[model samples]
Target: MSDFSAEETDLMDKHEHILSRRAELLERMEAGRQPPTSHRKQQEKEAEAARHRNESLLQDLQKIEERLKGRRLPAPSLLAMETRYWASLEESIPAWEHFLLGKGPHPADSRGRSPPQRAERRASTAQDRGLPPLPKHRPAR
Candidate 1:
């Protein structure tokens, strides 16, 4: 019984020594390893910076969209008004052409004479006053 007790005590001491040595080695390895907070803090800071950058980019995009909207194509009301004005001008084109061709009523000839007769009388009076006769057709350059 004494021998068995002595052997058990020796084995227990050896086990305790080995456990203490392993604990020391583990502590040294832990000390040599990088600190947990350094890498984590660096990553957290980078994420925060990225978040700020993304927020600024989003704001810039919103501003650009607003500017583009302001500078976009003409509004429907403006286009409609322009279309109405052009239509009015189109409706008046025939009157303008008649006036230019001397086919419209003359203010001085309010007796309601025919346009050709009025033009002929004016041309004859002008010729009688010694003016050169007007060309029947324009000569090509």
Candidate 2:
């Protein structure tokens, strides 16, 4: 048995084998013995196949990267939390406060809030002026 460790022996063997192969390849190049033939169609086919495989791998990597990015998000943003808080407040507005905001004894709609008192006043005023009632909601410009 050699004094060298198993890893060292394996590495040395691999190095020698690589060097031997390199030398043989170099010698063959120098001799120019039976110069290798070029198969253009076969090479093109192999290149196309390799490109397709690379594209497929790239798509898979992109999908995994996007999934990782999605997971990397820590939590709901401050703006989102604040928005939810305000929405809750809007929904929970008391019937008394809803009436106070308007002049008339406004009844709550299906969403539990009456239409703004200004819309009713506008429609009545428009009728008094002998004009068509203005739309409750404005059209986008």
Candidate 3:
């Protein structure tokens, strides 16, 4: 037989209740958890995915390489095309320079003014007519 006072029995009961509550809380916390995957299994999955991506990329690369090989241009024809392109570019330079210097009017614009001058004239005309200046672009908030 054990000798205990009423207060000691009550304190022991409280201690047991606290311990049981702690254990219950711990169990509940772990109940919704999943077990961790093994490292080897996780690594194997990653390696398999990488290999699949590599194989797919390799296949695409091979197809592109084959297509390019089939479409290879003859060196002589390629050189001739490049030569013609450069020659045309060089021929246009003198006209471009003349236009830039404002020595001659552009054949496209009969007003003999460049595009920027035309825009400025339009804006001035609008202002003279008491119309609102064209809305300047504002960035969206």
List the global CA lDDT of all models.
0.87, 0.78, 0.84
lDDT tens digits by residue: candidate 2, 26-140: 9988768544456666788899999999999999999999999888544679778988999887876665476778743644553455567657877788899999745598788
Residue 23 deviation, candidate 2, in Å?
A: 32
Better of 1 and 3 by lDDT: 1
The sequence of per-residue lDDT tens digits that candidate 3 reaches over residues 8-78 is: 89899999999999999998888647445676689889999999999999999999999999995779989
Clashes of 2: 0
Tell me which of candidates 2 and 3 scores higher on TM-score. 3
TM-score of each: 0.34, 0.26, 0.32
| Best model number under lDDT | 1
Q: Answer with 2 or 3, whichever has the higher lDDT.
A: 3
Model 3: colliding residue pairs = none
- Angstrom error of the Cα, residue 1, model 3: value is 34
> Residue 66 deviation, candidate 2, in Å?
0.4
